[model samples]
Target: MALVAVVIPTYNESENIGGILNALSSLAGSAGLNIHVLVVDDNSVDGTVEIVEDFGRRTGFVSILRRPGKLGLGSAYVDGFRWCLRNLGDFAVAVEMDADGSHDPAQLPRLVEPILKGEVDVVIGSRYVKGGAWRGGRLSRRIISRGANLLVRLTVGLRVRDATSGYRAISKKVLEQAFSGERSYETGYIFQVETLYQYYLLGARILEVPISFYERAGGKSKLGPGELVSFAAWCFRQLAGRISGRVI
Candidate 1:
């Protein structure tokens, strides 16, 4: 059986964490994939860690690494991926997902199937594809998402339809190559443009599977207001540099 690990970052997500853990636990035995989770939580004040610990006790399919304080999402994934790669028995793939239940765990089998079949090195659960859509969120957020992705493709030249999608699966080879050591990627994306661009540079074969992005199950949005602004600024700078024959 192939082993798959899902890495999620959490902070004060007490109201929402259990739903995803439950879904993942139930899906563990199906599709011939040994699914496990590594939740890297930045010390949530709202009893989030207790809930995760309790769930792990009952199912053993879940494990958590609690940080001392609220570190960024980038660090959470780095630590979570490293922990799973070293501990999970013959880990074959690593998955990234949101803790707020916007991304579905039921679709995980399909997300990692191509990796298991040696078809693609990365699979992004995209909303820009033919069957995918985002159900709710501020109108500003929706527009920012679309614009950021358009800029990611226009500047970075990646062929992916959704460069900002948080739900995705990566083959063991790609993970080992791009994330073997400390990498200083920013947060806000949950795994955004920089991470995706690194994957592309590694020559990873990427694909997008359409997935409907629902509103969060609970808690406020973690994305800060400045994230999009910073991303847009960077994209334009990269575009300008590329145009000037001095790619940054």
Candidate 2:
């Protein structure tokens, strides 16, 4: 039996974290998998860490990792992944999900099944794939998501349905390889795209599970027009570097 760590990176998500944790707990039996959750909080001023600590005290499968400050999503995951590697060294799977209820914890088993069965190293919970869609997001966000995915596919040569989707499951081997070196894609959401591309480049098998995205009813989205713009620009720069042999 492979130990699995479900990581949720958060910042100012106090309102949503408890409910998400409860939902995740409820899925433990139905998922038919042993799972531990690691909530990496970025020192949210909203007392998010306190809530997480309280929950951790109540649940054996859940715990909290407090960071010093507001690190980007990429770095939060990186930090949490490293901790998972060290503390939960026996874990065979490491998963990433949103703390804002956009990603359904019920879908985690399907995303993790292929990796557990040794069919793939990376499994993406995709909202753009068949049987997948989003609800309650502004029209502009929908367009940005579609366009960003297309751009990522064309730029990185990764034929993934939702490159920007943060919901994912990765085999330990793949995570080890990806984080072994000094990561360069530490920018915006493009980090997700770059990580997928790096996995593709390294010949890691990838799988996609359909997912429906829902807008958060509370708290503000960290992603915005600025994030979208920066991501596009970063992708272009990365593409240029790759073409010129400046980056590999």
Instruction: State which candidate has the highest lDDT.
Output: 2
Q: lDDT of all predictions, in order shown?
A: 0.84, 0.85
On TM-score, the leading prediction is 2
Clashes of 1: 0
Q: What is the C-alpha lDDT profile of model 1 across 32-52, one tens digit per residue?
A: 679888999999999889999
User: In model 1, which runs have C-alpha deviations exceeding 4 angstroms?
Assistant: 188-191, 244-248
lDDT of 2 by residue, 32-106 (tens): 678899999888999788888888889888878888987788888888888888899899999999899898888
| Global Cα lDDT for candidate 1 | 0.84
